[model samples]
Target: MFRSSALLSLLLLAIGGYATPVVREPSPVKLPFAVRFNNGTNGALNIIEADRARINLIKEQGAALAEKHENVHKRASYSVSVTNEAVTYIASIGVGSPATSYDLIIDTGSSNTWVGAGKSYVKTSTSSSTGKSVSVSYGSGSFSGTEYTDTVTISSNLVITKQSIGVASRSSGFSGVDGILGIGPTVLTEGTLSGSSTTEIPTVTDNLYSQGTISTAAVGVYFAPTTVEETTNGELTFGGADTSKYTGTLSYVSLTSTSPAKYYWGINQSIKYGSTSILSSTAGIVDTGTTLIYIATDAYNKYKSATGATLDSATGLLRITTSQYNSLSNLVFTIGSKTYTLTPNAQIWPRSLNSYIGGSSSYVYLVVNDIGSNTGSGLDFIDGYTFLERFYTVYDTTNSRFGIATTAQTTATTN
Candidate 1:
């Protein structure tokens, strides 16, 4: 899994920016799709090795995102499942009239809905090339290909007419999957298309809302904690959130205006480890493409010191003793007017899957890590899958705000 910088992330899904999802009918249309996580491998690397490599790559992608500001999944037809392949989330989607199925990575960090990374793009009566060259630079890979408008079928009930898609003639860094189903903001597409620097291609969600297939330009994402390589523990809803997937109120926060991060689904929030402050209110993003909860270097240091965790070379994650685990405090995130908590049990890596990442079964690994810089950077923290797994998130493009709420997994000790 490669990460894209700035507004350009996806299709190796460098997984960076998405598009503007606007609103239409007051009535919401529910389109459930299928999302699977790929916890499989990359050539010779096992699941854990692949995860570490992917994690390291995302750091590079984040740095690149800060520098370039451009490049940068789920189910439901309304269904989202996560399988473990390359440690990235994959979504199964259909394109063309006959509805050929393709497994694309579900990436909220990007908005380009393209295909042809692994499976060849199938052209039929519904496929039309727009004559525009599409390209995106993921930190570890890149792709440049022709652009096309095609009929996209997420499910029998949800179909998008003339959706913009990239068909890669040449691609590197993606394996076992097609291109990304970018669901990020529309602005990020500014400089991505070759020969069309200022052109903005409409994303799948953008078309869904515009077509009145859904009431609003929003997508609800749900992820459940897992220890196995694959499971149907994820869900994606288009148009509006699935009220059944979350508990309590779905609090909303306006997107942050900070640079770099502002180009994506950015937000502002603060963090605390128990009673002590760890990270001050700062701007960052919540990403489905990212796999961990990363904070600025300074905050990470404080967390490491607070928990007395030592860096584990084998897994590239922090390790703690049983005693430390017992004494660990809840890590709380304050976003907008609400505070969400990550219990100690929720902070540790899924213990049952320790061996997958080359960690001892008895070892306790912490998922929170450093973003390689201090706080105060335009983008300080990234609430990755680790954080999202404990909460239900809503990307409301219509109102220009994001939503978050606790879920059944909020305090799960399954780890």
Candidate 2:
């Protein structure tokens, strides 16, 4: 069944490989999106507008999950590379033998790789039609197309032969990019094909592991907190965790058993405002596609009250004065046995980029917001980029565990 969320999405792509996969460090590649400032870059996101879009997007994702079982099972399109357009991260990849290069979005939310949002998918000597139609609908975008198995290459050492790829016959909601490189769970591929309802297509990460491209059937994600409009500050390590990317001990948490949330890289975690438990452990997903930290409505209310923040319609984020900022406490997340902290400085949007998000230079906006629902709704919260930028995340499909660790950005006061 298909579930969706809106706004702020990009698909990721990589080099395709067909050889016996080797266990090498699959380092994360830099997206074209510049974390630069003072330029009309990063899709020039107006904070207020982006916040509103993101709110609706997250709600769509949550609601879509709720309606999943009622609807016919369907898979969504794969990840796209992120871009400089404040809302996305992008990657450049090749399709076809003579390798037609394309820039794609990076997505972790959905899995089903395809192309032709901007540039069309080129059929090469390696292309072979699977004779099955494919379709997926993201909240902000959707695509319908034919399936093809082709020689995919990620790098010199990484390549997958006969990888299933969607050649979009129709698509929407993508600009300046091609399509997604979905590395989501293999199960998501279920019901994506027109006639092959029971078939499960392995993801890029899956191919890397099943074919021995990496040591483990896992992917490690690292994104740095950025003040600039763009930065190649992110890394994706295939197979195993990169000890150099993190500090202290890496804590592993099991995927939440909750429906819908469990469909993705979901987990059970509790939130605390310093010493007080604002939201007890609940089912939620960690989405690289999402942009902010979102809690259930009740938890949001408690958090807002605790922080003395007022809603700012202009930015779709909570607003606080300098005094409130000074009084902000450490917002802690208890996952597994480890406690990850989002310090006071980490809560507010960077003062330097307030105008970009359509806020006053003098005022500060909180990155934490409402998910449009309350706790116990199966899925409760989303630890988006705001949270990921501070911590490194590893998705281990083989072991069914999600790992998190502290990064340099964890203690950064950049915002």
Off by over 4 Å in 1: 1-86
Q: What lDDT is obtained when candidate 1 is compared to the true structure?
A: 0.75
TM-scores of all predicted structures? 0.84, 0.84
What is each predicted model's overall lDDT from 0 to 1? 0.75, 0.73
- By summed lDDT, the worst window of 10 consecutive residues in model 1 runs over 5-14
lDDT, candidate 1, 298-374, per-residue tens: 99999999999999887778999888899999999999989999999999888877776668977799999877668
Candidate 2: segments with Cα more than 4 A from true spot = 1-86
State candidate 2's TM-score: 0.84
